[model samples]
Target: MAIYRKLEKEDKEKLVGIFQQPSAMYDYREFDEDALIADENCNCIVIENDGEIAGFASFITYRVPTKGLVGRIEDVIVDEKYRGQGLGRGVMEKIIEIAKEKKVSLIDLTSNPKRAAARKLYESLGFEIHDTGVFRLKIK
Candidate 1:
């Protein structure tokens, strides 16, 4: 059985293992379990298969002057071994549910063009791409 639920402290080791998978697009950042759990604005969902972590997704809600409350989904992934089993969809659906519960006015996420499958999933979940440029400044 697969269980989808909020991330718990005990899941850190397994979650870190998932993040260690190589991704040309994303670099692994230090996992701040305490910060994630302490911050009310951050919502993280984890999928557990049998006794191991199988997938994870998260979103952060913030107040925007023009849009009211909005969310940005981030770090969605399923274990490589668990791919093609609908775990990604299940985790994403759980994130959407959290967004609805928080009354978020809008939810946004960015996916690399190379991630065709991920982009397709987002589109199927009603996320439409807006014609806008994304700029980032690496401060670190």
Candidate 2:
């Protein structure tokens, strides 16, 4: 059986290994050791399958000033070999529990349009597709 737990300070090397992929869901190029180990607002959870890190989810909680308190799912990644399993759902469910504890009124995330399965997972978990436009400027 797999175990879902919070990232520990000792898990840095393993976590970095998971984040090092070029096509990772989150940009961890500047992933800092201190933040991963001590940041109160950062919650990084990992799933261990037979003592190996198989997947991870990072969440951030913050109040958008006038907009109110909200939680944002920074990233969710499951190993390619574990894709068909319900690890992603487990990650989200755990995050939802944390969000509720933090009194977050809303939780949001942005997913690639090409990730159809991921979209379905989010939608089934009660996340709605809002009719809003998002613009980004990439730096080279």
Candidate 3:
């Protein structure tokens, strides 16, 4: 059975392994477990299969004047060895449950066009592509 729950300090190493997979597109950052666990606005989930970490995901919730509380999911990934076992869906479902509990008015996520499977999963969970442009500026 898979266990889905909030990220724990001991999970950092295994979570890092998942992000290091070639399929993970984002620029890797050193995880500050203390900050992550202490942040009131961040909700993170880790999936454990037979006592080993199988996947990880997280979302940040904040209040917007117009939208009220909104959530943006980030860094969702399943270990390469565990793909196709519904662990991704399991983690995402857990995030959605947290969002609902927080009364999030909207939730958003971004995926590279190459991530067809991830896109399909999001759609299956009722996420729609909004007609908006995403822009980023990297500042050191």
Candidate 4:
């Protein structure tokens, strides 16, 4: 079984182990736990199985003039070895809890269309695909 907890800076080693391609998981060589904790509106949590990181998810809540408070779930992942065990659900549930606690009016996320399983999970959580355009310039 996987146990869920808030992420900490010290969990870097265990977290890195969960990603097959570390580059895809994170852009930096080191996990910046300090930055995450210091951020006022972001919450991150991790799932541990037998003292190892099984999965993780993060969300950021922001206030917009027109939309009120909103949250976006990001970096959701479960180790390939731990996928079938409902670890992803555990992580997402935690994110939803945080969103509710923060009084966020809406929460959203984006997943690759190829990730059918991911889309299903989000749907099960009551997320609907908003027919909106998502554009990025990719400045980097």
Best by lDDT: 3
Candidate RMSDs in order: 5.6, 5.9, 5.6, 5.7
TM-score of 4: 0.84
Ranking by lDDT: 3, 1, 2, 4
Quote the lDDT for 48 in model 1.
89
Angstrom error at residue 127, model 2: 0.5
Lowest summed lDDT window (length 10), candidate 4 = 131-140
Model 1 C-alpha lDDT per residue in residues 6-59, reported as the tens digit of each score: 878888887777877775233446678888989889988888898788978888
Could you give candidate 2's per-residue lDDT for residues 1-140 as a string of tens digits? 67889887677677766666655645666867667758889898888887888888887878888656778887688776677788889898888888888887778888888777878888888787776622111111
Which residue pairs of candidate 2 clash?
Answer: none
Compared with the true structure, what per-residue lDDT tens digits does model 4 show for residues 16-107?
Answer: 76654542354436458898878878787888988887877888878879777888887788888777788888888877777778877778
Order of candidate numbers by TM-score, starting with the best: 3, 1, 4, 2
TM-score for candidate 3: 0.90
How close is every model to the real structure, measured as TM-score?
0.88, 0.83, 0.90, 0.84
Report residue 49 deviation for candidate 1 (angstroms).
1.3
Backbone N/Cα/C clashes per model = 0, 0, 0, 0
- Candidate lDDT (C-alpha), each: 0.78, 0.76, 0.81, 0.74
Once superposed on the true structure, which residue ranges of model 4 sit more than 4 Å away at CA?
Answer: 22-31, 133-140
Q: In terms of lDDT, which candidate is stronger, 3 or 4?
A: 3
